[model samples]
Target: MRIVVARCQVDYAGRLTAHLPMATRVIMVKADGSVLVHSDGGSYKPLNWMSPPCTLREGATDDGQVEWTVTSTASGKGPGDTLRILLEEVHSDSRHELGVDPGLQKDGVEKHLQALLADHPATLADGLTLVRREFPTAIGPVDLMCRDAAGASVAVEIKRRGEIDGVEQLTRYLELLNRDPALTRLGPVRGIFAAQEIKPQARVLATDRGIACAVVDYDALRGIDDVEDRLF
Candidate 1:
């Protein structure tokens, strides 16, 4: 990963136009050919990012200032999106070699939920059995990969709160999983987006994409429901 702190301006062109005036900010160029622009203060989310598959070309502007242009590589009838960063002064520029990460394992709620669901795949659907937890993929690890009664592959994504972004993430996984010939032989891999609470918008999108949504009961999955009822 390459991290550069510089006084730079950013402009994005494609479906819409966005501009960030010159300021000191942190820029990250990941190994996967993605770029992210972040400010000193704000939420964890980057102010702007270009997801791969994309290309980053570093060159000089007409005035001899450093400039980096990132363009999407997606093939389509229309033109691809582009992000341009014009550097004025670089404060600190360094690159680090980060090896393969083991992937995130959130503690408390999220991790517990994954563990419980792995043991009780049927809670998500009838006749669903676990194939692997944290299944590896080219992009990243999927939370769960299971099989239905018909032996078809099912990719499951778990979140504490289901939202539109989560649905979109699951859609990407399904797209890649369905492309595998081994999994396709049984049937096209489907998806199930599971969470404790699902937003209305997310549910709608999942339905439109033909992906199933499962609202899990954390207490029930932990076997607490069998305990005698008690007032808090």
Candidate 2:
């Protein structure tokens, strides 16, 4: 996957001034040729990062609106195929901050998940229960397992941090769960690639393969105290 960051000058204080009003946006393009826009609340106009072999052309301003044309990388053929387009806005700094390190984000997400499971056991979806299981596998045991309620069989494999080949990892786990005669009786086995954010291609591949997947955000697990800290 390729990520591009673009910033626009919405308001300028002065050419020599140290402070300026700038709005930034991020766009992500996946290996499977899908695009996702990360919005920054509601500050700037939507922007997209064109995929490889494509170029963006800016048009004349009209009625206070900006337009751009996307041309193909091919030899003067025409505009390339539009795979995906998304609009995003920049949120105010008072509400949120940008450039959060990936490691920190993953840690925060894991902490929030732990807090949620501890606080709301009943909120877990059907056929899924939290378990602290030890595995004798080559890679080593996992911290938690989401298993089928009745058979106590591991249906989905989970990792707290780091990025793996999620699609392939989940597919292997689902196959193992389904292949087990004891687990097969429980019904069709599936997998969940739970994380802070599910990549665009991963989401599409998981859906196409009949595997259940979810992109869980930490916002859902924030407590009243957390909310208070953010507000104040």
Candidate 3:
């Protein structure tokens, strides 16, 4: 991972246009070729980022100032999406070798949800049956892998509360899963973002990516909401 602290201006061009005026901020170039721009605030979320499967090139502007161009590799009809970062002054630049992450350890609720969903895959979708739990992938393990009635592979990601980052994570898994011929034998691998509550923005992003979102009911799945057990 390469981290750079600089006074820079950022501009993005693609499906939309955005600009970040000159300011001191942190720019991160991940090992997977993703680039992220972050300020001191915004909690953990980066102000702007390019996901992996992209490329970044370091160059100089016409005036000889340092600049970096990050482009998406998924271009189809038109030019690929591009993020241009113009650096005015570099405060610090360094790289580090962070070994492979162990990945998130699901909390009790999320862990239980995965187990419940695995037993009741039909709740997510009719005729969905569990294939394996913690299906291995190059990056990490998928929460649950299932197959639909039509024999299509489905990768389900379980989250306590769904957010944009969760959706992005599932998107990456889907991308990697689809590449496996065994998983894509019937058709392209599908993705399901399952959580007790899914944020509006997360749902929108999942939909835009052709992934399905499922809102799971914890109580219902646990049988607490069962009519026979309820005392009205």
Which residue runs does candidate 3 get wrong by more than 4 Å?
Answer: 1-108, 227-232
lDDT of 1 by residue, 1-232 (tens): 9999999999998878899999999999999988999998898988888888898999999889999999998776136599999999999999999999999776537778999999999989999999999998998889999999999999999999999999999999999988899888998999999999999999999999999999988887887774357564
Residue by residue across 1-232, what tens digits does model 3's lDDT show? 9999999999999888899999999999999988999999989999888887788889998899999999888646236588999999999999999999999875447889999999999999999999999999999999999999999999999999999999999999999999999999999999999999999999999999999999998888887687566686
lDDT of 2 at 215: 52
Which 10 successive residues of model 2 have the least lDDT summed?
11-20
| Model 3 worst lDDT window (10 residues) | 71-80
* TM-score (C-alpha, index-matched) for candidate 3: 0.52
Q: What TM-score against the true fold does each predicted structure earn?
A: 0.52, 0.40, 0.52
Cα lDDT of model 2 by residue, 70-153, tens digit: 434645444434322212332331213334446634446555565565354323446567554433333443323556656544
Best first by lDDT, ranked: 3, 1, 2
Best by lDDT: 3
